[model samples]
Target chain A: SAVISQKPSRDICQRGTSLTIQCQVDSQVTMMFWYRQQPGQSLTLIATANQGSEATYESGFVIDKFPISRPNLTFSTLTVSNMSPEDSSIYLCSVEDRGEKLPHEQYFGPGTRLTVT
Target chain B: DQQVKQNSPSLSVQEGRISILNCDYTNSMFDYFLWYKKYPAEGPTFLISISSIKDKNEDGRFTVFLNKSAKHLSLHIVPSQPGDSAVYFCSVSGSARQLTFGSGTQLTVLP
Candidate 1:
């Protein structure tokens, strides 16, 4: 298991502003992902942050609206661009560690709670 | 459309009793299923999982059962404790390994 942490655990921002959330993993991992959990909704994956390359965005999510960057294997950032009240949700980062027993198991960070007013 | 579903938004159980949470999926390609527990202000923690080839997997007080034909899954916790009160999410993974999560079921283990 890996220890994951996110910066700016919670934040309040006005609409039309942008906020960047950082996710740091204790160890280098191969697969890093960003997920958003809207109020009363399921966790939806936003993108797969590729180290040293552009991220792969999910359906209904675009790079312009939610840009992602992964400069290294242990660090990544997700910035919500031109935020709106509808974008208020909890953002989480997760890493995949191919353990001997559980290859697909993923460890997550203590999400960032964002409120867009 | 939601590929995975948790019809029950919440469940309450008495302490020292059994707690069961159910989930269903529309995707037959899902090969792995997992259960995650989440507390307020914290990330979801991996609790248990089961493979499509197996019908059941158990870890201590937690047990996960999968039914391929019915496209249904369930998690059972024995001797439920107040500490188990939290939001439980059912997630599934396909060949790509990207997880598809359910809407989550809030379990309240009353003491």
Candidate 2:
């Protein structure tokens, strides 16, 4: 299992502003994923941050809106730009712990709660 | 379309009883399934998982049953405790690294 942490555990930001959330893992991982959980909704994948490569984002999400950076294997950042009320949600970071024989298991960080005003 | 679905929005069960949570997936290609538990103001915690090759997997008080033919899975917690009250999510993954999650089911264990 991997231990993950995120910065700015909870924040209240004004609309039109951008907020960057940092994710750190105790152990180096190959895949780091960002997710969003809106009120009363399931977790939605935002992007996959791979070390030394550009992040791969899912459909309905764009780079300009949610830019991701992975400088190293153990750290990554996600910036929610031009925030709106709809962007108010819990943003989570996860790391995949790959196994030699079995499939990888994802460990998550305590999410960063963003409430846009 | 939602690939994963948890029909029950919430369930109430008495402490020490069995708490069962069901999930369904539309994608037949999903080969891996997992369950996660979440509390308020926190991220989802990994609870248990089962591979499509197996029909059941057990871990202490929790057990996950997978039915590939039906495209359904369920989580069962025996001797449920009040601490078990939390929202549970069901996730499925095909050949990809990313998982598709279902809308969670809130489990309330009444003491």
Candidate 2, chain B, TM-score (2 decimals)? 0.98
Model 1 chain B lowest lDDT segment of ten: B27-36
Worst 10 residues of 2 chain A by lDDT: A97-106
lDDT of 2 by residue, B18-91 (tens): 99999999988888899999999778888899988999999999999999889999999998999999999999
List all candidate RMSDs to the true structure.
0.7, 0.9
Write candidate 1's Cα lDDT for A13-81 as tens digits.
999999999999999997899999999989999999878778999999999999998888899999999
TM-score of each: 0.98, 0.98
Q: In model 2, what are the clashing residue pairs, if there are any? A: none
Which candidate comes out best when scored by lDDT? 1
Compose the digit string of candidate 1's lDDT tens values, residues B1-100: 8999999999999999999999999999888999999999999999999999999999999999999999999999998999999999999999989999
